[model samples]
Target: MMIQRYNVDQQGVGQFDGGKITEQKPIGFPGEGSEVKRVGPLFYWAWAKAEHEGYIPLHPHQGFEIITYVISGKAEHGDSLGTRSIVGPGGLQVMQTGSGVSHEEGFVGSDMQGFQIWFEPHLREALRRKPTYQQFEHEEFHQIDFHDGVHVKEILGDDSPVALETDVHMWDIHINHPFIYHQQIGKGRSVSILVLEGRGRINETSYEAKEFFVIEANELEEMNIQAEAETRLIVIEVPTTVNYPLYRK
Candidate 1:
């Protein structure tokens, strides 16, 4: 088991939306200048910040499940499925581009921050289903408040609105003060953490804003995460038994 950690500077950064949107892409598409991709069905993990309102024109995607979580502002979404809506802070938007889909997205405020994660399903099985979309608000999910100044928000889990056909658990944790939180992963499950704001120490290693830490399945154990200050982070735990064929440059 191995734990891999990456700071924001170690990840690939790019500017889009006419340079208004500066993105730190942990994984990106071909020809996009990002090289970080996962194996065994998980393709991309990205955290983006939009300093100003802007749009990414209609683009086509297929054979992937895209999950969007808005952290600060609102994002207007429109897709070929005739879905048009706004996902605000603590809101989630998911699009399963089984066969294929075209969509457009735009930030809605002076500062919009969010995460866009790409998860892959069995390609053969996915192509047999039509594209679909699911939306969920913060209230629709379960929130567990710990006595140690830590709050865990389950975004995609057994009690969440956005259900996936895959075996994955996604959570958002916000620490209002100095505290530690522990999460136990199953034997065959891998865990990944992305820090959104503030600072923290994970496994004796201190991490600041926009850092990502990945723990292999064999390394699954209780993680000691202590917030140096008010901190917010996202965690993804998934099965490591499956192999995902990724597309890269």
Candidate 2:
């Protein structure tokens, strides 16, 4: 299968708090200038960075499995569930907005960074269920550390406490030296790659920081990623086809 890459300029730029906070949206909505609106069950992806401590006011969401992954500093979450908590770097907060839910976010510490992603499931069934929320500390997630300076933290999958109706798997990977991370993505499924830092080569092609790519496979095969610089990236794998009726914008 072939791979496609979108540079930073190809994505959407969002500024809040009078530019105190900025975000790059790889899959933003219309008028956001992001050519890619979505991939399979993956609905949205936003890489947010805080220049100074700030917050986003309460907002509504419905029928989407949303997740926020903290990359640096600290993040605070509050929602209609009466949940209010703070999460440091490497932590994550997930919300399954079955019917509807409202939430607010605040980021503290200098240069705080994180990602907010939304995944779609069978809306009909999800809407019938109640909204749910959960937060995972940095230690609760499963991590694989290699002596070669390669590391992987599974954000989703069997070992993860996060359970979503969306058939997607995600991970945060890092490497400092020449290394290869491998995976076998089943046929008809695609991998969404976000290069958050440094540079690397995937399928023999070079890519630098702030690059977003999608790989579609014709069959199950090893997906090899080789990086030489100190790098950090995110990967989300989802089926190419939707099994249940999906909600359209």
Best by TM-score: 2
Poorest 10 consecutive residues by lDDT, candidate 1: 240-249
Screening candidate 2 with a backbone cut-off below 3 angstroms (N, C-alpha, C), the clashing residue pairs are none
Clash totals for all models, in order? 3, 0
**Model 1 residue 245 CA deviation in Å:** 5.6
Off by over 4 Å in 1: 30-35, 243-249
- Collision count of model 1: 3
lDDT of 1 by residue, 1-249 (tens): 567887665677767678877788766665555545673455787777887787888999887889989998887889999999898999998999989999998876668998888887777788788999888887888999888778999987787777776667899999999888777867877787888888978878888887878777665477778888999989888787676444443
Give each model a TM-score: 0.92, 0.97
Could you say which candidate leads in lDDT? 2
Residue range 50-152, candidate 2, lDDT tens digits: 9678888999988899999999988899999899988899999999999899999997768899999999999888888899989999999999999888889
lDDT of 2 at 24: 96
lDDT of 2 at 126: 88
RMSD over all Cα atoms, model 2: 1.1
